[model samples]
Target: MTEITTAQPRSLTTALDIPRPPDLSWYVQARQPVGYEVNLTRGLLNPDNPALARSVGADGYTSVRTLVVVDKVVDGLYGKALRAYFDAWRVDARWKVMPGDEDTKNLEQAVEVTAAMTEMGILRRTEKVVVVGGGVLMDVVGLAASLYRRGAPYVRVPTTLVGQVDAGVGVKTGVNHGTHKNRLGTYFAPEITLIDPEFLRTVEPRHIANGLAEIIKMALIKDASLFRLLEETVAGIDGDALADCGPAMGEVVSRAIAGMLDELEPNLWEWVLERSVDYGHTFSPSLELRADPPLLHGEAVAVDMAVCVALAVGRGLLSQADAERALGLMVAARLPIAHPVFTPELLEVGLADAVKHRDGLQRLPLTNGIGDCVFVNDVTGDELRRALEFVHAYAGTRDGVRDGS
Candidate 1:
């Protein structure tokens, strides 16, 4: 056996007994003027038009180059015209087409798009990456652009009702992870969001309703006038009405976009906890991810908003009559007011998850009344359970009416 010798470790300790002036500690405040324009236009993809070029400051580049990531659906609908437009403008463009379904919107897709941008030698400072598609495409491509070289400027051209009025106007770039919706994402504002309501012409009726769900969310949370507009004009919000630029449909899109921007501008990074925009988001994330034959993003949001309406009513924050009116409006617009997957147990799980996201408290946004919102950190589990039950029952009653049963 080798002799084991232990060497004692000497500790060097010093105490500052003498008074020393504290190193001047102060925060360096920075006010970065970060803003993006939401350009509502028609015929943005037309070669003769300069909307796309001017929005991106294309002339600023010695050689105007664009890297476009398009949803396969959008490409199939308008890719030839878009390519021709780019050629006619003498804009150097590299196009990559991929399906933009929820299943395909993930970190893997982000990585793939980032790789393609790299291959195209994307100039992070000058060349713009234009994303054209619906919400999924916007999210995945935005994530890719945000991750490449820490952030490369990009433009959004949302080609769906939901995209234009809701997803496209905001700065959130995200992709689903495992069972969580928007689990991996960053808040990256686009250089510009070109919203052509004309895109809605190509969208399905159900998709139009999907977008209306978000419009309803904004109306319920922040703008009473917008809510009234939605209620009064719900009948004229179908696909054909939107394609024809009907006044009702036009107002819905414009007001929804404006209302959302109003809510987002003040708290771009969400340092503020009292966010009205979070009204439909907290509960919907889980419901959207867990549903079998999964729900559309706005569909899940509509259901969650119904649950919130119930919660508000139960708390005496919103009148029962107002709750009914809100639900009726959702019904009139053909949005889902309740979903079968929203069980009490799932509500508990979803709230728990939301609490984690909201930083250890349930910063749940409930309507003080329609068009006004307040956050509650002390929402009891019992209240949530009751809200779930009320929504389920109310939805059933509405369904019975619809079926004439």
Candidate 2:
């Protein structure tokens, strides 16, 4: 008579390990710690600033070689200044200018940027790519830098209001693909990001409004004080006011940046699909790409946020008065609360796509109240239809002015 016993497996040593037979499987694990700075400065291209020059780890005595990928519009405005700054710092910079609009965010544009890097003989590790433009340009060049030699260092100098406050501060690089916004993208951190509010002076009023929408998203989902500040100062806030960097705008920028960083730092790779920062993003991607005139990124987001607010109210997660105030703030900021393109069919399609993107659940972020958020996975088609109808009626009360009017 023989008694048989099974052997116990040894304990796993790594986070990614499976407790399988060593002879049958192998496992390895590694963690990459990403650290980067988002610096707020004025006149970044001024030769005397030294902020941009120092970011590349350059001293005054030695000449550094680097590639600069800039948006054509930004280049037109600051090319000479950038040239003089580099020349003064004894740095050799190769300039690659490309169009930086929503329409131009694509794989081809990213390839063009990579080609420019190759032509300039970019050093994979030692030298860095400087991206100067709005969110679109940053995404394109960031993707290019990420693809070059598998991974190359890059710096972001976001020139638009959206760039300074939202896109420029984050580590996501993406381009729209075939009618899908940010369908193709990568999570690549920049070496550093320089934000200059002074750049906003030349931005159009409409674009300024576009940027404010993102700030509002932060307010609704994270900071009640920020929402109050926006309510108080939105009447006087414009591109010029933001460029001036006065007390109100400065606080707005500071809080928005801090709030965004707070939400992002904890979950940079988004291993957790539930996110408060995704409040307005759930449906905006589809609407942004489908609009006839092409709504700006923030404009699309505003419409989505409005609908989500209405959804929250219907669910009793937010007060009716709070919903009105939130929608009112969007109008005051000159952002769109409703659009013709955001139809019931589009809502269904967007939710379907979002479910796929969020790992087989809606995970839709809705404002529970001012400065708070909740995710709902069980949102039905009827609910979305009612929300859309509510948004349209709310927009009508504003003297028949809709988005793009």
Candidate 3:
């Protein structure tokens, strides 16, 4: 009889004697402050130079355990020197050599790197994985480090021009997934990035052009003075000249690095999608993954830039003369302005993918003028076709003259 009586439950509002909001949820806020150094020096591997040794931070320990991942080609060229430097600094460095090519930039390669780190028994906090190579290897190893034990510290020693100026400076690490470029990736910052232009001396000429394309992209969208410098020295600029570390080429490297960091530091995670640094990237991913012989990343970007230049002209965002000047600079730098695989259909597909990547709108970056950019949401297939046509025609004319009838 006593247990038969039921008690009424009190309302949440009445229990607390306060009004309850319509939504029932708790909000959490956090911030991850990212900071890293990009050090530029000559002779980074020189046993006498303390830059690389200092970066390794092996002061107290008899031998600090470190995993050093290097490009196969770079290892072939500089393996002895690297060994000597490590020995001189009394650092226990485990070497992992990987192919630093576009084809090797994939999830499997990243897994291989992670496996290497596992085999080395990488100490998560104390040890660092040092990647020495071009952009592709840097990306793969960065991705690997980001994945291993949730996240591991790593250093970047970019041996190629592209790695030195563009990819090496950024916090984005990715490997190509399926046919998509950088489909699986994470924004992981390295402990430090070491840049030594002396390494560019061994880079092939075509690869040099690859790096120039990215530099040109930065110049077009951010620094008119950088563009003027490139324009003035386009004819003489090559891997050899850059390796010489002359003033003009020196300025180009510094300015490109400065411009890229300026753009990247503010938008580390790309919280804002309308990135001016995305100028030639909208369509280049598809073109890069689809090309038959496999165009270099920068070559694909060069072609994509050519198309964007044409589109900019059509939209009156950039003058025809400036567009021509841009295209001519690409040509002078020995970069391809067009590729057979970059068809209108591919452009449409790439734009669709870009729209999704940019979050529902085109957000297509166009060069408003030299050193300035504007983003647009509306870009039709017709406009893309027209831009492709103009690029093709321009390439044809340039080829014809170069071929001398």
Each candidate structure's count of clashing pairs: 0, 0, 0
Q: What's the distance in Å from true for residue 399, model 3? A: 3.0
Off by over 4 Å in 3: 1-25, 400-405
Tens-digit per-residue lDDT, 1-405, candidate 3: 466868899987798776456655577999999999999999998887988877777763478879999999999999999999999889999989889988888999999999999999989888989999999999999999999999999999999888999999999999888889999999999989999999988999989999999999999999999999999999998778999989999999999999999988889999999898898999999988877777888988898899899999999999989989999999999998887778899999999999999999999999999999999999899999999888888888784112211
Q: Report how far off residue 297 is in candidate 1 (Å).
A: 0.4
Show the colliding residue pairs in model 2: none
lDDT of each: 0.85, 0.91, 0.90
**Residues 1-405, candidate 2, lDDT per residue (tens digit)?**
899999887656544565556546747999999999999998888888999998886787899988988889988988999999999998888888889998999999999988988888888899989999999999999898889899999999998999998999989999989878888999999999999998999899988988999999999999999999999999999878998999999999999999999999999999999989998999999998988788899999999999999999999999989999999999999888888878998999999999999999999988878999888999999999999998888888873235444
The 10-residue segment of model 1 with minimum total lDDT is 11-20
Residue 105, candidate 2: how far off, in angstroms? 0.6
Give the winner by TM-score: 1 or 2.
2
- Candidate 2 scores a C-alpha RMSD against the true structure in Å of 6.4
Per-residue lDDT, model 3, residue 324, is: 90
Error of model 3, residue 4, in angstroms? 31
Give the CA lDDT, 0 to 100, for residue 384 in model 1: 81
Q: If scored against the real structure, what TM-score would every candidate get?
A: 0.89, 0.93, 0.92
